[model samples]
Target chain A: MNELALKELLYKIADDQLILGHRNSEWTGFGPLLEEDIAFSSMAQDKVGQSYAIYQMLNQLGEQEPDTVAFMRNANQFHNCQLVELPNGEYDFSLIRHFLYDTAEITRFDFLANSSYEPLAQLARKIKGELKYHTLHANTWIKKLGNATEESIGRLQGSLNKALPYALGIFEPSPLEQEIIASGFFAGEEVLKKQWMEKVELLLSQTQLNLPDWKTIQPVLGGRVGQHTEHLQPLLDEMSEVFRIDPSAEW
Target chain B: MKFSKAEIFTLLEDVKDPEIPVLSLVDLGVITKVDIDGEAVHVEMTPTFVGCPALDFMKNEVLEKLKENGITQASVSISFKEPWSSDKISEKGKAALKQFGLAPPMPAHLFTDIEVMEHVPCPRCEGTDTELKNPFGPTLCRSIHYCHTCKEAFEQFKPVS
Candidate 1:
């Protein structure tokens, strides 16, 4: 791929991480419990750190400065998944969202860890280590909520029902998907989706919750293509407020 | 192509934990083995905690630092055997912790008998009167405690895994 195309791909990854990190940060100090609050915040910090690395790479590649790419972009220009754009509704909903995202991300990072692109491969290796902790955190909650009181199980099931469609949106392909796959930057989307489903299914089997039938669920579009839900605008507004004030200011 | 072992040990010491920046794995007492065979250097490390985020960062930093110091073929092997513990911290590391405002680990022998004593003496205040608040602190490695004498809340690093 050309430099422009590569830069766009990098931005897509960075933007996804930035938006998700921002969304997750909203839960700081407000999580269901103290341990969870710290865990969520830690995960949010990791996402922001990952975004920083990608943004730095983009700047080095001469595409645009990190601030310009992160804060100056329009909502429609962001390439994060639609699921990450959705606001954290309830604790159960947030857990559901986390479970789905972490499962997919684990598979994604595993493939990226071996990318032919040296920098990406290195970042992926670092990210994969952190991602393992995230997966464990999500899995702990899933199992706890799944086996807890009937009320907790009911609430968790409701969250899964509501969020699963949007969770599927995370797999939406970019235009450079073929090149990325061919270059060994990532495994094929189909394979990734399958792996994600299998992992999710395995976890679900341990709980009382049932996996939603794939055929019945309609996939939400956008996110990967820069289209976003209504919730993204306010999030972008808050995140970019500082950068928008003085674009030239050193962060 | 011959190099002294002491030179390579210094290179390994230069690579600090990325998250904790101030503590090298050696200082943290997480480095389990360092072997030099011909031109290749191999370093083994155990995590301070089972799921530390700094593991990969430390590994990469070790490789880069070794290469920069003219050891081109350095290998980092992670081991879980002989898991790291606070007792493994060198005397110098304990002094560094006290200097850095973190409470150093109490002598391992003290922990067994002081099960009921909720507060250890504040390393800063030298006061035996203190209270334990939250077991979890800002980071997984710390626990929140308050010093009654100094009227300050501080994070104390927990025992290493």
Candidate 2:
């Protein structure tokens, strides 16, 4: 790949993580319970940390400094899916989103673990390890909410139904999808989407929740290609405000 | 190769954990790889956990250690693949944990075993009659437990995810 393409690819990956991390962090102190609060916050931190690593890789590739790459990107340039950018609705909604995203992330990281790109492969391996715990945390809550009061189950089901279409946005392939897959930098997007669906179906079955009709929902858009909801601009502003104030200042 | 394996290993030994200054991060098994090319040394490491608060400090520690060891052209790179796990704790680090009065973690897979439910011996009292109060303690890594015999509360490292 040419330098510009590689840099763009790295930005897409890094920006996705950064946006999702900011969204998740918004739940730090507001989760329904204390243990969950800590767990979600921890996951948010991991997302940011992962983004930081990707940014460092971008720097090494001689694209731009980590701060500029993260802070300077306009909303449309971000590649995260609409699923992650949506507001944390209710706790159940957040959990539903977490369920879908974590499962997909685990599958993606598993493929990346074996990526032909040595650095990404190594990074994926590391992220995949942490993801095991994330899956556990998300699964625990899903089961709890699924088995709780009728109200809880109803809420979860509603959230799951509402979120499923947007969750599909995560699978939207970037323009470089072919090159990335052909170069073995990542697995084919369709295969990954299939695996993700299988996993989601299995998990839903375990929870006795109905699988949303994937065929009927209009797929949500804007994440993979950098189009995002209004939620992102403010999030980016808050996240980068301090860094932008003094780019030369040591963090 | 510019540097011998033994010399490279010794230089890594100087990479200490910023949180716990007494122990080298390598001894903690956080340093995963060391590559040498002539006079250049490249070190690859991961944090003790994802989003560890001490990551920046640890990164600087690696660079400082290599520089202090006379490696002028050394580079320390960070990775997140195969994220750090307590399972990677070196035997030497395990011993150090024991000496610090923190019980080494029981493997998560073996957590359901009755043997693991048995009280961990208190480091202060050397008594096994302890009761777990809760799974979370002072840190994400520990659980709060108390020894009946010693009448003292102690923290035990929980087998964390």
Candidate 3:
């Protein structure tokens, strides 16, 4: 088995969940409405829990403790795509990001569900089940906001366009993409991206939103390789504030 | 005197969900397995939601219930090997939820295939003309629905799959 490739794959997936889950958790008490506040927080818990599970798998593979690995990692050490780490600009942007990112995630879980790796396939089953609601939440709101009043439609459309490039970055090829694919672990990002694009197009079509042709967009890349936006480090620092107070202390 | 799955299940019936106390963990299908080995009792569980805070509470409750029932040694573990679905909820649990003024969970297949159900069938009025007031409710496990006929708003358990 290609351990490095598998570990790298796990890192990216785990990081994506953790970072986005952190961002979503910020919505607690601050969502556009009370229901949305609870909804985002609910999904945030699932995302964080999912990340913890995958990190536990990593610990089995000889990585650090889940707490140390997650709370101690610097921005550049993270393997999550740039899209997940970006600031939640507004409800419109946050909603758009959720829609675009989750579309790919559910697809990734589907691919991983049938992976030759037994552990990943098992984890995928549980993760996919939880992600189904997240995508459902995103799609329902996207359609509602995408086809709503002029202001709502305009806000979603603006955010959608701004988020497209970053969303494409989610499929940035891994350093050991081929090794991972050759081991029958995953079908590779190219396949996942195609499926994501198709799914996104289909859903976007249902609303008044417009998606630009794929060929014309420059995909934002580099979060998988540990490169990240300015937004990540501050978030990480804030996250680990209490944990860093005393690494040896138990909560 | 000996312990069996039937009695163990009966003992666990008193362990209710923290959020919705009307239904027991067994009724929600969270208690998937109960096994007896010599003097050790092993219990396997799955959470209704991956992030349900009540997981630890439920596990502790199970252990306490078993110990109180004279099974002093017991272990309760959460299993994530298989996904959980609302379809696993018992008929008694569904009725309990409705009688408690909360709508029962819809079939898993019907809930996930679409964003929201057009007709939720209000728990109070049994009216199919209920509107999805919001796909999200006060809690993660439910959604808000309003019955136009009864002019009352209620919550339905969101099908988890």
Which has the greatest lDDT? 3
Q: Which 10-residue window of candidate 3 chain B scores lowest in summed lDDT?
A: B109-118
Report, to 2 decimal places, the DockQ of model 3. 0.48
lDDT by residue (tens digit), candidate 2, B20-118: 454567777778888888788888887765557787788787787777768888887766554566777777766777677777776655554223535
Please list the C-alpha lDDT of all candidates, in the order they appear. 0.76, 0.74, 0.88
Per-candidate Cα RMSD to the true structure, in Å, reads 8.9, 4.2, 2.2
Per-residue lDDT of model 2, residues A133-191, tens digit only: 66766776788778888898999999998999898888887787777777777786688
Candidate 1 lDDT, A2-29, residue by residue in tens: 5655565677778777887787888898
**Segments in model 3 whose C-alpha atoms lie over 4 Å from true places:** B112-116
Ranking by DockQ: 3, 2, 1
Model 3 pairs in collision: none
For candidate 3, write residues A1-251 as lDDT tens digits.
88899999999999999999999999999999887898898889889988988898899899999999999989999999999999999999999999999999999999999888887897787678778878988998999989999999999999988999999999999999999999999999999999999999999999999899899889999999999999999999999999998999976
Lowest lDDT sum, 10 consecutive residues, model 3 chain A, at: A122-131
- Docking tier of model 3: it is acceptable
True contacts kept of 3: 0.49
